[model samples]
Target: MKKKIVLAYSGGLDTSVLLSWIKETYDAEVIAFCANIGQDDELKGLNAKAKKTGALKIYVDDLQEEFAKDFIFPMMQAGAIYEGQYFLGTSIARPLIAKRMVEIAKAEGATAIGHGATGKGNDQVRFELTTAALAPDLEIIAPWRDERFRTQFPGRAEMIAYCEEKKIPIQASAKKPFSMDRNLLHISYEAGILEDPWFNAGDVKYRDYFTTLSVFPEDAPDKAEYVVLDFDKGNCVAVNSKPMNPLQVMKALNKLGGKHGVGRVDMVENRFVGMKSRGVYETPGGAILHFAHRQIESLTMDREVMHLRDSLIPEYAKLVYNGFWYAPERLALQALVTESQKNVSGTVRVKLYKGGIHAAGRQSQFSLYNPHIATMEADPTKAYNQDDATGFIHLNGLRLRVNSQVNGPANIGG
Candidate 1:
């Protein structure tokens, strides 16, 4: 029996061609696996296409619920926003896809696993590192990095030409000079025309190939939609008081939030490999969850704990965004994030309208909010001490005063 290979296939232009390339080059049986992480209609007819394109069999797993509850909710809890704008939407999905691909490779007794991630992008690192962590023995085949693949197809236009020569059916539309990746979590646009940082998407006369701008929200809906997220040990359990599977809740929120245009991010972020790149993302469900989770934390977490974690949020975000989801430092920080959320078990009410998700109210069995101590207009017997301020300010500013007098008044460096 010939040694077999399993590919992480998407049935897209690149993966479609990769299927044939792998089969011809290795003379091995190619088993393609697709994970349905909320990709919707994109998964339809993928099996047929894979079979026709030369795959012996195609495996498509529905991982939407697992993706939301396991991957996305943790990111939201950790406040894992990349560079404070890009939400690590695409970054989080790669590990899950690659992890499963490795599992399939093991089950099939395949000696190798292949992916369509390009050479010059972050997905290659995200996919390969995950494969390394999960199945180090299995050889990874990245076609874009391969000398033969590069020579045969050096660019997108050449890939398209090969697709046409091979009689692969490709849909034609209004010309779009950019590439987009869409999953259940979000849709990201980059490369080609979008590589230009100053190119206004709205100014362009062409239509987007993979995303629908018509779904964008601006005018407010007539009524506000209120959602309640149930968190247990930092994972969301329910939405809108309904006991739902995690993936189901994400799907529900995606529909609800997409209509209102909740999660859209555009930014220029520094890449892990040391280049700044421009990207636009749509993360409707994720934005709503993060906003609501932070609201509940504000009412539950201790002030000092919250402040300390808030200071480290950027670092935590950086770790996840940089593809260290399984790294030791990230796991250690996750332990801290989870510990702080022990009492974060509760329901948070959020109001969604227009493009923003606002926390309407929050309640927790372990809530630290108290009316007596929190109210500012209360009587003298409140939670804070008024006389303590006299010594507090002087003690805190003692070094500041001495340093200013000694080294030119109010000198910061002193």
Candidate 2:
């Protein structure tokens, strides 16, 4: 009996060609698995395409809810944003896809797991590291890194020719100006024309080509849109007073945010693979959620706790971006993040307009914001005692006063 190999398939040109190559090279039966992370119509005919390309069986799992609730929510709670710009859209989705692929591989009793990620990109690391953490014994077949595969198909033209000769269908047209990766959270465009740091990705023609979830800022409506989001323990549970599941909340936000041109980001980011890559992202819903989550935190979270979490954002974001989602360090960090969200339940009203989302107002049952104490109006009974500030200020400034005395007031100018 031929060995069975489970493949992480997308029905794209690379995976299509890879399906045939794996069969021919290893003399193995190929089972293609496609994880449906809300890519809409992209997976419509994926099964037929995979079978036509020589997959003996195909698995398409609808993981949109899991993607939003499990992956996206936790990252949001942790405030994980790569380099202060990227929301880690493509990076966050890979581990889930890889985890599902590994599950299918085990169920099918496959001897090997295969993926179409190239040698130089971050996806390869994400996929392989996930497998290593989950099933280290299973052989990982990465065609782009395989010497035999590289030698046989030197470039994309040769690969396309091979696909044509083998009667396999391909979706790639002439070299695209940029590459795209889309999931429920966002759509990202990178490489090709975007490889040049100075390239204006927002040029009318290019922006239209790459944008999926949002319009250009200038094209957004003249009037602002107000939407209210409800959070339960840091996860958004409702929008505009209507309760929704995780996926529903994200979808509704996407519609509203896209109309307002909310969540468009362009940046040069450092890839885990040791390269600085330029990327443009449209994360309409995610941007709103992040903003609202922060707003809610301001009312409910303790100031010192918020500051500590803020300090850890870079590390938490790094783990997700670097393909360490299943690593012990990330798991430990998530434990702390989860604990921090215990009192983050609240409603946040957001004002959305061209390329911006602002937290208009926020309220929570556990709110630490005591307006009475914060009010400017003085209490005749001296509730806060303004006279107390004199001693408080003197105590806080003792170090400065001591330093000035020791150095002498005249020498302080030096």
| Angstrom error at residue 272, model 1 | 1.2
Ten-residue stretch with the least lDDT total in model 1: 206-215
Strongest candidate by lDDT? 2
Cα lDDT tens digits, model 2, 1-414, are: 999999998888888999999988999999999999978888989989999999999999999999988999999999889999999999999999999988988899997899998888999999989999999988999999999999998988998899889999886589888888899999999888888989988877666685688898888899999999999999999999999998998899888989988899989989888988889999999999999999999999999999999999999999999899999999999999999999999899999988889879999999998776778886655568878999999999998889889986645354
lDDT per residue for candidate 1 within 1-414, as digits (tens), equals 986999988888889889888898999899999999877788889988899888998999988777877788777778777767877878898888888888888888899999888777888888888777778898988888999999998766877777778776555234467777777778888877778888765332433442342244544476778878887756677888788776877777787887776787768889887788988777888788778778888888899989888888999888777677777888899888888878887888888887778888888888898776667776456558778899999999999899888886863484
TM-score of each: 0.91, 0.95
Which parts of model 2 are misplaced by more than 4 Å? Answer: 379-383, 400-414
Residue-level error in angstroms, candidate 1, position 327:
1.8
Stretches of candidate 1 off by over 4 Å are: 164-175, 202-214, 219-224, 379-382, 412-414
Q: On a 0 to 1 TM-score scale, where does candidate 1 land against the true structure?
A: 0.91
Cα distance off (Å), candidate 1, residue 70: 1.6
